[model samples]
Target chain A: MKPPVISAFEPPRRILMGPGPSDVYPQVLSAQAKPTVGHLDPLFIGMMDELKQLLQYAFQTRNEMTLAVSAPGSAGMETCFVNLLQPGDTVVVCRNGVFGERMRQNVERCGGQAVLVDNAWGEPVDPQKVEETLKTNPQARFLAFVHAETSTGALSDAATLCALARKYGCLSIVDAVTSLGGVELKVDEWGIDAIYSGSQKCLSCVPGLSPVSFSPAAVERIKQRTRPVQSWFLDQSLVMAYWGGGAKRSYHHTAPVNALYALHESLRVLAQEGLEQSWQRHQEMHQLLKQGLQALGLQFVVAEPYRLPQLNSIYIPSGVDDATVRQQLLRQYNLEIGAGLGDLAGKAWRIGLMGYGARRENIALCIKALEEVLA
Target chain B: MKPPVISAFEPPRRILMGPGPSDVYPQVLSAQAKPTVGHLDPLFIGMMDELKQLLQYAFQTRNEMTLAVSAPGSAGMETCFVNLLQPGDTVVVCRNGVFGERMRQNVERCGGQAVLVDNAWGEPVDPQKVEETLKTNPQARFLAFVHAETSTGALSDAATLCALARKYGCLSIVDAVTSLGGVELKVDEWGIDAIYSGSQKCLSCVPGLSPVSFSPAAVERIKQRTRPVQSWFLDQSLVMAYWGGGAKRSYHHTAPVNALYALHESLRVLAQEGLEQSWQRHQEMHQLLKQGLQALGLQFVVAEPYRLPQLNSIYIPSGVDDATVRQQLLRQYNLEIGAGLGDLAGKAWRIGLMGYGARRENIALCIKALEEVLA
Candidate 1:
């Protein structure tokens, strides 16, 4: 048989300000295109060390077990749950949106019980309710919640929740997927045990890596687990042998070399901007977007106190078709805004100001394009 | 506290011929650096359609469920098990190397009962033993095994195992992580119900993606399940809403847009090479490496009849320290080869000749480096 011919792949260029996959910085793109190196090469180890250091700075934790997980944010979530909770362990998980529901699933699959603390979509996980749940489930091993709920543009109070977990003698597993660079997340000060964040959200890297940190208590649980971790790939114990501090890196599955290169460069950019500056930039852009949306007579889906600056969720104006407006925005304006998911679908739109997307120019352009579409 | 300073990153060149993450093609590298786009953009949807078609060709399967899982190969494994087996389903899993052990873990984690068929490390799974286990565990719903054991460089008879599954009226889940683009993998012809392979292996794309395909039977099982998939991210039913057939795409999590671009380009490269031609090249390179290793007095760890041509596992010479030799190979020649894993660690070395690494030059260089290290 003759070989199949490959057609040219030319991706249409567009400004990304969606819930995730925020734009890529030029230098990060270049870094992604760098020559491939063996995962265990000496210089690659040096690069790993540098990556770990940068992640520490970004996460604001001295947790020695910090590194990029080989997969996406979902995989990072799975890693935390699988490594920490053994079969039959009870966990207090707060659910306000999509990610919280995912945590419940991870808990169940790990053979652990999820004592779900429910809240309305687009609302923050109430720390009072979380505390009540922990009291109810006195033997719970951990409390898992999303600091920034990407599906609904709601930001939970991470420090308060971590404190609640601490009071109950439970570990805290925080999902910082959309909050890492866009908000203040101090893993050490907040007493977060395990936190996982996505690179594409505000780090401006391509979406393949998830930077994660595990506090000593979480690592202790992994080490003390009775059964071996169910998933070998996500097992923290074995993965640490390969990704942990050392020149003699053991073989895990081949590390995603080029993707890590992109992440390394992305973290470099965050370091240059400084986390506080990046967080402030996201907030500033959100303000600009909020003003524009209010001018157009749109209301925010999340309350002001709980709204995430990086992810702006708003109600679709009356008399406008949801799908049609988003489609037109993409086709004519070359702009992408996320549609609401689950209960909010068809009623709201999620306009993201995150990472490279959280820029003054992008906010103005999105507002202009949205206004034109709505008109 | 002062944030870490951002330093310019420049990747050094090296030859990666270890178990996986072989030298990436320049085009694939550049593809990863392409501009980001929304996961649900019309153009990206079109590209995703093309990617599914390309994956179908690569896997030699007509399964419409062919697509890349958003996470890495481990997540891909989870997707297969979670979709096919409901809780308490009996599964017969064969374990000869590390990946096989991983499959067993996935089976157990998914609430499936795992009836393990154990084989020694660096040995191919014996079909007779698998048949015997199936006879003993007559209630087994599926048979799972690795096609190319990355850890031990052993090649099992996927065709025979799949045929056995058919004969016994059971489904088959095959792990073709190191075999897909480097060896013969006929999913349709072999009657494989579900299969998952890694991008960083023979495909030579950046990691963080797992290309997976499911036959009609597997899809039916997924649809008929009494319980919802425990993993929302990996639930094929929900994922299908996003990656399945239709002009209208649904939203799941954000797609790793640039990573898909790289994967599509790598598949195109594989198609251009022609599957048969690529398989032949792997064989030829293996022949060269075998001759050189024999000359260097290195004996094969796996039997000749069952050895994987792409992953060459050979016993380390007595008195030569495994770590020192591997380090020297990396430091002096800038060549990377894998040390043995699992039970074979410190006893053997695995020299991979996969995809771009399956060249005469790389084989000769690896041999020369080995000879020098031994001297």
Candidate 2:
């Protein structure tokens, strides 16, 4: 068979207001286009060291085990689960949305038992239920939850949950994929044992790498594990040898060199804006969008306090077809918004106010596009 | 403590001739800087469909399961292992070099037994030995081996291996990380059940994506598996829903959108050049490099017939210090070549002529630089 003649792909310009891959900063995208370099080059290694420090700042933690996992956020979540939990171990996993259910899947696949603490789709994980589950399954080694559930736009109280886990002598594994930069998350202050986040969501970087950090206690648990990590690619112990501090680095899989360049630039942008200021920008944009959405008679699926500012889930207006509205918005306005996932599918639309996407212009564009599509 | 200040990262330009991540084409790099789009966008999904077709052309297969795994080659290797093999199943793994050893690790981690067919470090897997092993271990469900061992610069007989696997009623899982575009690999004709390759190597794209293909037989095995795949992220069964045919793509994970752009551009370049021409160019460059290295008293580690054209592993002179010579080459000439791995460490240097790096000029420059550094 003759090889298909594929021409150069030129992707269309998009106003990304979706759950992730929120419009990457031009500077970050250019960083990705920079000349490729050997992963083990001394200059590259020096940059890697700086990248770790920058990641530390973005994660709001000075944990020594901070580095970007070479894969996506989902792999980062697996890294935390695979490294900490061994076979026959039990974890109290709080399931509130899509990501939380994914956490349960990880637990079961790792040969560990997941004692699920369930909550409503658009509600924060019930702290009372978590406490009761932990009290009952006292042998549980970890308490896992998603801080900001992207699917439902619900933000759980990570601080209270971590405190509960600590009180119950269980390590906390937090999924901060959607919360890393758009929201306020102090990994150190909140005492998150292990946390994984996406570079695309709130970091305004290209989608590929996952920034992960481990508290010292979490590192200790990994060191104390009797069995080897199930997934070698996501194994922190081996990966650390490559990303670890020193002049000498071991050969793990080739670090995604160009992607790291983009991550560094994105994190540098985050540092310049300051974490608190970035959080404020997301919240401010969310308020602007929320007001516009409310004017259109759209009700938010997640309650006000529990809602994630970065990801706003709103009910699809009556008489509006979900796919039709989304398609029309894309075709006419070149704008994109996320459709609801899981149980909320077809019932809601998720409008994101993430890092670089959190601008007054984007808020206006999204609202105006929705209005036109609805009409 | 305040966040450490990180300035913009400017990577130094160098001619990459390493074992992998060879010189990426300028067009491919520019493609990576393209505007980021939503992973699930209709336009982006259209690009993904074209990408699958391009991958099919590169792999020389008509399998509909061809797609790019979001992570690097190691994850791709894991994807093949975790999806096909179950607990207590037996796999005949050919261990000749570093990647072969990695395959054993994957097998063991998946709760499967790996029966080893060991060969010398710089030699290809002996087909006779493999047949003996498979015949004795009749219960073995799979035959796993690396087609091109990056560590040793040895090219195994993939056609023979695949045939033997079929003769024994076992599926074949081939690692073509370093072989794909640089060598003659007819996935359909050779009857390879499953195969994985890296974008960084012969494809001349940036690192962080793995192009994989599965024959109908391998897909059948995945579908018939009694247990859920161990990894949620690397599970091909779940990932197929997103990368499979049609317009509506399920949200599995946020793909590396810009990186996929790079891969598409690289694959287009490959198709334009044609696979046979790419293979011939690698071989011709290898011949040029061979003459120059022979004059410098360098001996190849692998035998003439078994040696990979793209990755040429040569022994260091008895009196020369490996690190000093490589460092001098880097510092003085701005060139990157690979150090030996595993058993060949400190004794061999892997000079790659992969993809865009396979040029008469690159071969000439590498030879001249080595001569100057040695003097």
* Poorest 10 consecutive residues by lDDT, candidate 1 chain B: B245-254
- Regions more than 4 Å wrong, model 1: A1-6, A87-89, A132-141, B111-113, B116-120, B227-230, B295-297, B371-375
**TM-scores, chain A, per candidate:** 0.98, 0.99
Candidate 1: residue pairs that collide = none
Provide the lDDT at A252 for model 2: 91
Which portions of model 2 miss their true places by more than 4 Å? none
In the range A1-375, model 1's lDDT, one tens digit per residue, is 334566858887788877878888988888988988877777777888899989999999999999998878887898898889888999998999988998998899788999999999999999888988998889998999999999999999999999999999999999999999999989999999999998888898988688999999898888888887767677788788998849767776667877888889888888888989999988988898999999999999999998999999999888889999988888887788888988888999988888888888898899899878887
Candidate 2 lDDT over A1-375, as tens digits, reads: 577887778888999998988989999999999999999999999999999989998888889999999999999999899999999999999999999999999999999999999999999999999999999988998999999999999999999999999999999999999999988899999999999999999999999999999999999999998988999888888999999946799899988899999999999999899998999999999999999999988899999988899999999987889999998888888899999999999999999889999999999999888877787
lDDT of 2 at A357: 95
lDDT per residue (tens digit) for residues B303-339 in model 1: 9998899999889889999989998988898888887
> What CAPRI grade goes to candidate 2?
high
Clashes of each: 0, 0
Tally clashing residue pairs in candidate 2: 0
lDDT of 1: 0.87
What TM-score would chain B of candidate 2 score versus the native chain B?
0.99
